[model samples]
Target: MSSSGTPTPWSYAFIRLLFRFVLKIFYGSIVVEGTHNIPKTGRPCIVCANHSNSLTDALLLVTSIPPKDRNMLRLTAKATQFGQRTFTSWLIESAGTVPIKRRKDYVEGSVDNTDIMQHLMEALELGDAICLFPEGMSRYHPTIAPLKTGVARLVSDVLTRNRNNPDFEISVLNCSVTYMHRQHFRSDVLVSFHPPMTFSPKTHPELLAPIDYNNIRLLTTQMHEQISSGTIDSPSWDLVRVAKLAARIYAPLGTRMSLGDHVRVVRAFLEAFKAAEDGPEVDGEHPEEDEKTPAETAELAQLRLDLRTYQDQLARWGIKDDRIRRQPLPRHTILSRIIVRLTWSLCLFSISFPGLMLWVPVFLTTFYAVHNFKKTGPIFDTWDEIAQYKLIYGLMSGLCVWFGSAVVTFPFTVVTFLLVPALMWMTLRWLEDAVSAFRAFSALVRLLLVGKPTLRAMHVRREDLHARVMRLAVETLRLPEDSEAYFARHGGKEKGRVRGPWESGSRYFSIKRRRKRDWNETLRLYDVVDYPKE
Candidate 1:
């Protein structure tokens, strides 16, 4: 097999058959819209969407397309997913899959996005249709997250390579997959496709290339509008109405809502449609930020206003977050895939109490919280960053507890009590980079179990998984850390500079500019978080 280990045509066919059976058994009345929008045939193009469920969406896409078009689909599955099964892993590589390390918190670690961009450009040059999810991962909220500029970069690179010849106009079809029960079983799964989106000038340099933050913003707005089409069917809810509703909802949320927040509202509105169509009765778990004590409510209110302002800017561009109801997907629901994770702090708090310790859970959740800006599959995104490692971080702390108890059992009980866990914590902190690869294997298995179809316990191999993670680390992250621009974030250089969410010190404007600044554009606000470092 080729080194990347993409699945072969036969393997993909098998995978498609297998998943089709699963969909038949579990997902009923699957409805796929916008079929007319798919080009009968075209140059290698991009597929972008917001991620909600798991890689099952990949199966849906592959299954829906004809075999002739199947080969044309060189899906960019996250390298972390390579270990579901030995054959499955092999199949992924044989499919001519490129092992891109998009988000660093992956099992194999982060990717060199720049290299991935280069690889993607070449794939497009071959007239291969490259499928990608702009959102990084499945989001918990009703809305989409802010996207990384990597997509813009990919679009830019492909067009740049074909600058001399613009005969092949790129076809980017935005598909919105809505589920009846995103967390339940035997639900309806509906996927809607949109007319292919093309850059304005039909050129790369001034139009598509020289990608900037605003370009990233514009792309996000259009995406918000596109995905919302099939998902949101409200006749009255034009871009204007949605914009106004979003403003009202966000008006009181407070000023801290980043551009990401505005994006999420649009994402949420779309998700609400998916939930309404596919989900059973998903009462959001997180308490309404809009409803809280006076001080807290005011804080949320201000954040809400900031989000509306962000949306308003896009509305001015006439970027429509409109709705065009088409047929919905089949009926089914998402199963409870939530492997509830506990943090180390909670563990410490639990063990500290006697009776409560007796009732504490024996096993902590092992899943990692990977955040992808915008994703295609429910789980896999074009780029992903680990938002919170509290899951695995707590796992490490548990080991520290057992090892700590044994290492100092003989003497100095107090010293063991005080120093062991702390020492263990500090020591393990250094291992974060080293153990990251292995941790990804554990995370992948969890994702497959909770997200992918097939409920029986999976026979996943760890060492094999670890090896792939290692390969991924070498191929996706270790190398690209030196290259990709997306990997580059502003780290504060001076003493007064504030720490960024990801870095030890993120740069933001001092409080001096707080009142006068435009929250969206000002350095005083709009701080970005990196995958891990943030």
Candidate 2:
């Protein structure tokens, strides 16, 4: 196992490259934005993000960093991950993660954070960037959990030591990661970085004059707002669903929307609906700024009802909005595409046929193992853990099969072992392509079966809904349907400015931006009483 200290740059780069490949295989697409916001190499900084997935969040965040500066990352993991002397432990430790035992993860009186805090401080002093999930625990939720005080406290303590020295400073970068399907294989994810939040004597002289409880709270609130802006935070899953559907329906047919833009549209819907529900804040400073007229509020309500109706309509058909958005092609056109897709799948299958013969047993064993194990698998609190277990089990099962085969074919052992990973890669490609082709065929068949009149009716309804929503988004929210136009209007000359919906302290997001309520108390308003620990 490698030590937790920084590794050689080359080694770190190689590891990053390896994980990048692994992630690409696991996810359909990993879109990273705001690379420009990453702090310079050797800068003392803390990278913070909302945690929804368990280990996958960390892997995605770490690999998203530029290769040259990847060596500067020091990940923070749960202490339990390093408790066992196993490959999992070695892998995490080799990644240079410091282990922190959260109070909830152990007996109430058994956890200590002194060493963990020391390690993080030392890492920062050495100019290494430490990454942490301020929300503490990873779980499936519609919004960010209440942040723990660790990050705020750490920054205050570090600043206290530096005392009024402008030469020594620390930056905090907030990365927001969103998953299209957190547990599904080959789903998409987006990682967005916002401008770094810096705290130094030159920037904030008051914090150094004396950091107090209020200062810590202020820093924590700022961190919360920054991270929240970058992520998809909603009051409930119902709003999340409705918002996603509205965004989907609002898009033009066959338009390729970036994950960031899609997220912005969804946030627009969520904030608009939430604002109407929360009603006017009489005491709000900018009451007139965002106070929607009665007609507009009623229009929003009508839009919500229409969106829900459309959602149910799509659900009844058991199809995604994309299917509806895809402009109808001539029968011959779809048939031609189907044939091409099938032919491509056949070609890939033929190429991988030889490897499949050798790896079929391993694949079947893995399938059966996962199937049986899941029944008795350790109960997990998050959907990401299900994927995590599949990954671990698949790796272990494949290795065992390779070792056993090597032993059985003693003389050809070297060749057998060498071929394992290569064959596995070929099989993976074939399976993915074949499954994709089959899904396309199924969708095409369903399309063919549906009457053209029904499709036309659905299209008409979609178009009307799209027009109304886009108008409201443009006029009411000042968020245009066209992402480029919105960016141009807002002077987002640089990338990562799809945040217009939440910018300028819009009254709709007033509670989120101003954070008037205590963080914990606000969490209770969301009915999340069981606060997670870091």
Candidate 3:
């Protein structure tokens, strides 16, 4: 950081590239959208996102933005992070993080953020971008927690600063980051940047006063609405699980979806569930529409039951959902596929063997890191923490070991350091293929051991369940029954389109209640704002 407590340009660039490289190593794929929505450096910007994964969320947000603006992007972290005595804390400080104390992180009247607020204001005055998670804390959950008012408060303060200078503007970008499996190694991630939510003292005068509690509350509510729309917001993990299963079954056999498309389908299912439970009010006059409602409701209930049963059966046999085929493959075809997969894996393994040998120290460093994490008093607790520890420890320690060796073996130092990362990448690819091949081989063994009648019965049950799921989804989501048609209509070459039930302003799908009960009470016990009773 420079003397002004902002990240120097070169330091910021180096850190940004380092993060990008680590991300490439960690996640299998990273899909970023809406880069054009990022605000220019001339304006003060606030990049707010939903927090699900712990440290990686921040790393993803920083790397998703354009490189030119990254040097000016100052990330806001929790005060607790600043107080930590670790290498991560040192890096956070050097990266010019503005630390603010949360109410929950401290006892009442223990500490104040007066100084932090002043520092943030100073950074904004220079048109530096500020990024933070409005949820206040990172979590491992399905639904987004109720957002804290920090974002609104900060915007109000910035607006107050710009009251006298009408030319100055503030841009708030809601960049929601989603993960396929947050804890899994080599999972996919999607970072989407929504259009900037701009504010100016001249236009939004009501928000200019820092002490305007009403306006601040309204702004926070608006921010939550926008952020929620971009996330996979549901009531519970159970709902998320069911929705994902339903989406998978709804697709055609051998169909694969990109991360964005998968997120859209899952969220749509979640929203449909919410809408069905809410059961919109309808006049008693329309008998035909009324009769259709209960039949669809019954169909959904049956679908859920079948899905749960199938899930339990798969669990019993230690089989994955994706391994279930609608039609059993010919024996020769299955055997040939398995043979080809193992042959390819073996060839790649041979190629990566030498590189792995050269990076023995790095492997040893990672082993130690894992051992430390498994201790009784481990520093890391969650999956995100463990993954981050492995990455950080491996990079830092590997570099130190290589640098020390380079001094003694002076001639080939540059080539040695350069070769390590390439070797690491090659090893990663070989491991992925080897694991996939092993799974295929295991599935093949199961097929051979299990009798044909039992396997055929399972296949028949899956096809029936899939058909039911698609039929229900078509009625509720208002999409074509055929998977290809749905994809062609909404899944464009670029952005994945998601149409909400109410997007068309149609009341046809909204069913009248057969029974009266409050659905909002059934929601998860998170801090989310209450939904109105239908």
Candidate 4:
């Protein structure tokens, strides 16, 4: 046991501390409940959670398990991951992950080996918890996959073999991972822990048998219900799900949609009605194709239409359909992301470099100044957006060549003349960022000084924006006038802006979000409206 006794080890404490740091720093949350329901001192236990995303759910749970029971948490992981040379793979093993080989063709002895059973029992007999995803594989959509009997049978097997520890317990948490933008920044995740499933049998004559499993089935059905409804409100943010629900709520208000905006609308339907396992096939009866409530059927029809439109637009913009569909950056393809990142990170590491490394500074400076110019946002039609990145890369590659020439031919007059200006430009950009950072810090201080007044001013503005946006949306949608009615009630709000502005007394809000690139250039490319020169 690494550290689960009364006196915990420095290593265990360090691990726990490290988990908190990582969760806060890198875009995750531990929104679990009913942790207390799992006994601190009990018989063998198994923990199960829904699988979504690549590794976020398991990693979060692994990091959150109490150290007293840390060693006991014998987690199961994919075999290939264990073979990888990555630090995460090594960490997985060191943290005591059991390798579950993906079996292709099942043979007599090949099915669930004795060694695996031995490992699981050894872990439980020693009073440790085993964690696993019963679904066995991750899914992209937000819904609980079919519950496997592995957990149920595992508990049954453990009890039959041990025969002695009759009170063994098992816990199952139905978790949903909602991504904001799969490939974007500050993505949110949500975790919900349902009540535990204690082993008990309804038919066992021996009054005292394995922890009640009849109780467990009831628990799982209950979990499926909560997750299916999207009602488990954990503190963890569901980035993609949130946006979708927001879009559904806000779309009716005439908010012109973006591709991201469209996805959200489709996502709500997917979450609510997208059945995972196909139900019994319908015969000739063919249940009403439009059986959905009139409003729901209309929404579903609209989502399908919107998705077609969004995809066509992406195609029209020359984005290869395959690429947009396969946007999740692969763990192996990480070098590509890193290269693109370090093309920028050359600047980060340069700040700590002994001297102003020539290549790094110039690259960073031009990149920053160019990006800042997009504060007002550039009108990049899809082609223009694609072209902009390529141009930047060409410039960066050229700059790198120049720096290389200067370094290889030091003291060469011609090289120095060109290198000197580029070097100066880089240095100037760095200086500007440094200055900007300081000014930002000072502005924060001033905001603090004028906190209440500034807050009040912001509140007023937000309220005004909200009111105007509502008025505009209602009018655009051609809804019958009612002073007491709202866009939310008419089902018009879209793209995640709710009447309740994530704060109380919110004064104003903007539908005009200024992301670095105004991908919606189509909307504003024209200087004047149809009624121009009025």
Candidate 5:
């Protein structure tokens, strides 16, 4: 590693490749959008993002960038992490992570971070992209926290130092990382990059002086808003879960909505509810003596209660809304359905048996270690637990599989060492595939027999409630009947095409071509607000 916090070319390339491979294996799918917003090559830019997942957040952001734009990327982490363990410090150092003492550390009489600050400034001066999580620390929060002023200070320092250099420019780019099922293996992740917020020296030469308190606050708030724009900032995870299910049910049947689209629609519904709650009255007249009528208040309350109830029922039944939505009641007779399920179960069992035998020990050991570790430690947040479990389990089990197999087969021949490790690796891959197959089989059994009637009833009730809510939204909000008209007015249109904020380059991730219709269908389904016609 170079002394100035920038990685040597070879080390950078190696670490980048390693991270890509590891992320690919850990996450079932990773979707990235708005890559076009990142300049292929340009002046140093600060990439700011929300912090939730521990080390995984940094890894995802770094890997998501295109290789051409990724080479110059440098990341920062809390200094305490480097001090805790030799392995961690070495790993982060190898990846070119700069360590800075946090405010708490300063209070504890830790050495000043002037050297670290110099390292960062030097890296930026060399035109390297740097990523920082403005939240200062990771937690299991559903929304972004109050941002620290470190980012603002760094930007100010860099820009002020280079004020006389017209050719040098600094920009702050907003990125958001949304996990579909965080803490679960094989979960999906969506990484989105938004357009850069440029701060040109020529345009604002007065910023050459040291940044003041007000300017730092203003800059931090602006960056926070930009980063938070792409994320669904909910009050609670339960609310988010309920909102997603409601969005899915309200969405037209047979339409395939991407997880990102599902999240966007959920956020919109939450926003609408918030707006209604804050509004003085539903209409000009109040049904009650107060601003809120009894009926209107009751309906809103019931809506929330029903959503929570539905979520509880789904959890109790150990089934998800998607499974019910995708695999609706089969048109076959009971006997035929039974036979089909049995056949599928047998097929899955046959494929998964060998891998299960080989990998069961590793899986069980990792699971036990994670749970026990959590119990012994200071309360671990969700993402922290996930990061710890994944890192420990992945390293420990991987080593066991590679070396244990070699030791066991040593008597056979020298070639047995290489062959055994290869075989073990292949078995691990097969185990992942088997786990997916088994989950599908389990879901099918639940849908077809275990809770079929209950699912059907819930689906019916969900549809009814959705319809009632839509009607309520229309009446209370005075929404337009035709969604296209609403879209045309609120969303900018060109050549008969309407673009909502979700489609903005700096707002949200875009869906694939095949799923584009699904997103549009969802928008149409919930486009209840009325805006004045142009």
Candidate 6:
């Protein structure tokens, strides 16, 4: 058995490189911000992040560390993940995971975490960066869950043990990972790091004085706030979906907003909503409770109803608000574009038909396995389960294809072994591209043929509601109505000015800009009662 403070083996480093390569190929992009916040080398550090996606969260945290700061990141996983088989156990062990018996895995009060803490303390003392999820388990909700005290306890123990060593210091860093769409393939991720926080045994003796409960609670609260900062803590995916659509409608027509921009707007709106629901805090200048008048409350309820109706209408149309906002062309023009896109897609498919056919079985098996897993997996575990299952199934299927191809070509030459794997990979790549092209073509067809009239009406209603919401934000929220500021904050440039729908060539207006400012400051306008208000 490997000791706790042992240096990372060569095998772990090799596997980490392979993991990074696979993540780069799997995720469309992983944008890292605030890299400077990572503590300098030579001291122990603990990285605490919100846990949402299962294995992907740990994978990203380890991979995002710069090469200079790179070391074995010792991660904690449930004992079940370590597996019972020798081969599986060896694979997980070699990857630098510390297995712990979780509370859920045992009867109440029976689980003991002393060994886990000991292992973590030893690793930290040896200067390894330790990554652990404070939330304990992955969640489906947008906001951070009430954190378990394990992290706080770990920090406490480490600080207590190293107090006599003058040169030893420990820092805890907050990392927040936001996914564009967690369950969707090829979606983007933003990993934001906050400045490291240090707790000294000298400053707060209670941290080390017999495992003080009050001190631990305070520390845990601080960690929770830091981790939750700048993250989208939505109540549910449905509200997120609504917020996204509303944001698209709230923007100037024809603007092609990037996914990051969309998420920013959604997050801003959620924040605003939270502030509104909380009312004003008790300051000397404000009332203890800034109670809303009955009339105002009624008006707000009506507005929410309208928004929900709009969301349902969007669902029925089979199109997203952003798609409508981006492609504001006439019916005839949209039809023409669909035809052109379909023709291009058909041409590519024809060219890739041979490769597609060869890879079809592998793709089908992988897809079916992922779909069934999603259907049967626990709701909160959906993303993690799908990601792990897909990766394993894909590798297994690839090997099967390679071996089959090699056998068929074996009579020709020994070179078939290498050639077959390369060919199989190429075929899979072509099939993936072909499928993407087909999906795009199909979406365009749906918009033009099935959703034409509904989309036209939705566009008008979206514009009107957007104007009303902006008015509410300005008058009620006391937010500014600065178009330039909104565009600047959203990372978009204003093209021209807003124009009336009746204006000439309005059907295909420049998605670039609008002249008139609809409303100004962004607001979080989603419902509060459905999901925990925060």
Candidate 5, residue 339: how far the Cα is off, in Å: 3.6
Model 4 earns a TM-score of 0.47
Better of 5 and 6 by TM-score: 6
Backbone collision tally, model 4: 28
Model 3, 1-534: lDDT tens digits are 122324456656677788888776666667787899987665678889998777778888888888665456788777788868898897788777778787777876677888887887778777778887888887556778898887888888888877998887888899888876554455567788888899988988888763768888888888888888876887766566667677767764334344566677777777766555545447555455434476566666566667767876765665555567546667887788878877866776687687666567766887687677657442223444655676777778767765766665669878867765566666765655555556556666666666567878998898888777776678757656777556656554322233455632232111210110110011111111112121
Q: Write the per-residue lDDT of candidate 1 for residues 133-231, one digit (tens) a residue.
A: 777655433345565556666666666666667465666778877653343222345677788776423553554555565766676667767775545
Model 5 CA deviation exceeding 4 Å by range: 1-8, 83-85, 105-107, 210-212, 252-254, 274-301, 322-335, 377-385, 403-459, 469-534
Off by over 4 Å in 4: 1-13, 28-43, 65-72, 83-86, 104-112, 139-147, 162-168, 182-185, 201-300, 303-534
lDDT scores in order: 0.44, 0.68, 0.67, 0.43, 0.63, 0.64
For model 2, the local distance difference test gives: 0.68
2 against 3, candidate with superior lDDT? 2
Scored by Cα lDDT, where does model 3 land?
0.67
Query: For each candidate, what TM-score against the reference?
Result: 0.42, 0.78, 0.81, 0.47, 0.76, 0.78
The residue pairs that clash in candidate 2, if any, are none
Writing each residue's lDDT as its tens digit, candidate 5 over 456-475 gives 77778767776765664466
Ranking, TM-score, top scorer first: 3, 2, 6, 5, 4, 1
lDDT of 2 at 367: 63
State how far residue 57 of model 3 sits from its true place (Å): 1.3
Q: Tens digit of lDDT per residue, candidate 6, span 1-534?
A: 122344667877776786676565455456677788886555678899998887778878878888566456778778877867654355567787888787777765688878778988887887777888989887666768899988888888888897776556678888888876554444467788889887666765677848759888999999898877757776555455555544545554334333345456666656555544455455556564455555665665556567778777655644445555543667787778777777766775676676665567666877898888778766665745566555556656766776777678768546877876555545544444454455556656667766557666777877777777777656665444653356545543222223456542442232211221211111111111122222
Ranking by lDDT: 2, 3, 6, 5, 1, 4
Where does the lowest 10-residue lDDT sum fall in candidate 1?
A: 525-534
lDDT of 4 by residue, 1-534 (tens): 212322333543454465554443223122333355554534456767666544555556666565443443556877667868865565567666788765643334455556886788766656666777776665444345666556655666655655554453444444333333221212233344455555533323232344466744654566555444433222222323322332333343234333332333434434333321123234534465523455554543444344444434433333222222222334445444444544443553356253345446545654564465446443221211222232234345545656666777877958675755555444534433333233323333333443445445544543443343334334433333442233225332222334554521231122122111111111111211011011
* lDDT measured at residue 473 in model 3 versus the true structure, 0 to 100: 74
Error of 3 at 414 (Å): 4.3
- Which of the two, 2 or 5, has more lDDT? 2
lDDT of 6 at 221: 92
TM-score of 6: 0.78
